[model samples]
Target: MDWSQVNWQPQIGDPHFMGWVTVLVYLGCAILAFKLSLNATHCFKQHIQKQRTFWGVVAFITLLLAINKQLDLQSLLTEIARTLAKEQDWYDKRRKLQRIFVIAVAFTGSTTALLLALYYRKIIMINALALLGICFVIAFVVIRAASFHHMDHLLNQYIAGVRLNWAFELIGLALISANAIRRLNKNTRHRASVD
Candidate 1:
């Protein structure tokens, strides 16, 4: 496995209909999250720092994930790992390594979610759906990273001409967007009452 033999080109993992739809959904969600962040800033006005921080974090993560949806950064990472395993003559043991990697990722994601929950406990009730949406997207990403053949096949399958992956991705984005709209409305009402 020569290093020169491996192609280092960027690969577009999904370029089809569902892929584009998913990307659009991600972009829409990112915009909503950003709006939520802005609303948090204007509504709190330096009083509730936690609210500002949480929405800001959500906006950042959503924006990054939206970019990643089209760039397919995960595939690049997987390719690098695969190439390294081959070069190191450990390609045969990739399955074990992949399992370990997936487990580590899942643990890290869960831990981060727990920390966020604890830190934002005061607002969790209001943002619970958005949090759940974020979890779904993260779970979808982790499952894709696991790269199991059967899982890939399943995700590729169509139900009523709709890809499973699209459904999973959109559902998460929808939840986040819904939560953002709800918050924005609540904030507007509160401001009106204050005025």
Candidate 2:
């Protein structure tokens, strides 16, 4: 229980092939979302400000997720909590604590999403696909955070030699990218029509 004896080095949660692929996908999605946000900024169209806010949030979230994908910062959080539980003589009650933590995370995430959707209702209708993608990403994070043994095992399993986690994460990134490309194209066409 000595804090000095504990290893404080940073660890790579997923250093294998599929992990890097997931990171790349996250970066790609972030770039696309950032581009979409910039497009909104340079436009004079209706709801431009709303679109900017939505895409800006998406870009920022994806960028942070990209960094987290490789760094596995969440593991550090888990480790800290574990240490605290042991020090407090409540390590045996960690299961209950973890359950409560996961439920709280789920509730907070769901409430935040609902509030955002309501606040950006018009933009949500326009970028519903990206919103869906965001939900998928959020769900993946929550599930991962839960760190349930069976769920973790399932996510770690190989699907046609590709990690299942990669599939789940990439699917969400693909949706966001697809929406960004679609909106950018639509904007281009709109400018053409205007000219």
Candidate 3:
């Protein structure tokens, strides 16, 4: 199998299925974001800038996972073989570790999203969601750091323009969480003053 000679089409391998899932999940997140932050701001029309920003961050993380599915080891090997003028993976020891990470994150994300739906007006839920994100990122980074050689030198190499996107997403999540905390504090102060 000549990887160099192989054609890398947009519909390559499992990306087709995973890409669709990503799109659907992102769209769902966007809708929920609008609803969650609808009353966030003092504006009249209900502009959830905070929620919008948060969802964008969520979309970025989910995007990374979704993209990882198709661009993983087995699929990339085929692409590499096609482009490199030969095939590889003789030992069948493809790193393919991204699949595990994706499964973990997806399960956490989906489960939390469903739980959020149940607690639409609860500030505690937002705090819990932020904690969940923190745990997942920390666990993943620790695990990956420990098992660095499993995948290629850099993770998410197969996807274009998604490099370090998860980092940015984490930063965004932190910022929004801070804002939510501030808002919670201010509301508490106002209630205290009234009492």
Report the C-alpha lDDT of model 3 over 38-74, residue by residue, as the tens digit. 3344222243454445444544554554354345433
Q: Clashes per prediction?
A: 0, 0, 15
RMSD (Cα, Å) of model 1: 2.3
Worst 10 residues of 3 by lDDT: 38-47
lDDT of 1 by residue, 1-195 (tens): 455655556656578877777777777877777777766733435445677677777788788887888788877667777888878889899888878887898899899999999988878888889999999998898789777788889988999988887888889888988988888888888878879
* TM-score versus the correct structure, for each prediction: 0.89, 0.89, 0.31
For residues 1-195, could you state the per-residue lDDT of candidate 2 as single tens digits?
Answer: 667534445767679887888888888888888888887733446779889888999999999988988888766666676777788899898878778987888898889889988998867776888988988897897778666778899998997987888889888888988988888888888777878
| Model 1 TM | 0.89
**Candidate 2 residue-wise lDDT at 107:** 90
Evaluated at residue 28, the lDDT of candidate 1 is 80
Candidate 1: which stretches are off by over 4 Å?
1-3, 11-13, 41-47
Spell out the clash pairs found in candidate 2.
none
Query: For this target, which candidate reaches the highest lDDT against the unseen true structure?
Result: 2
Clashing pairs in 1: none
Poorly placed runs, candidate 2 (over 4 Å): 1-8, 41-46
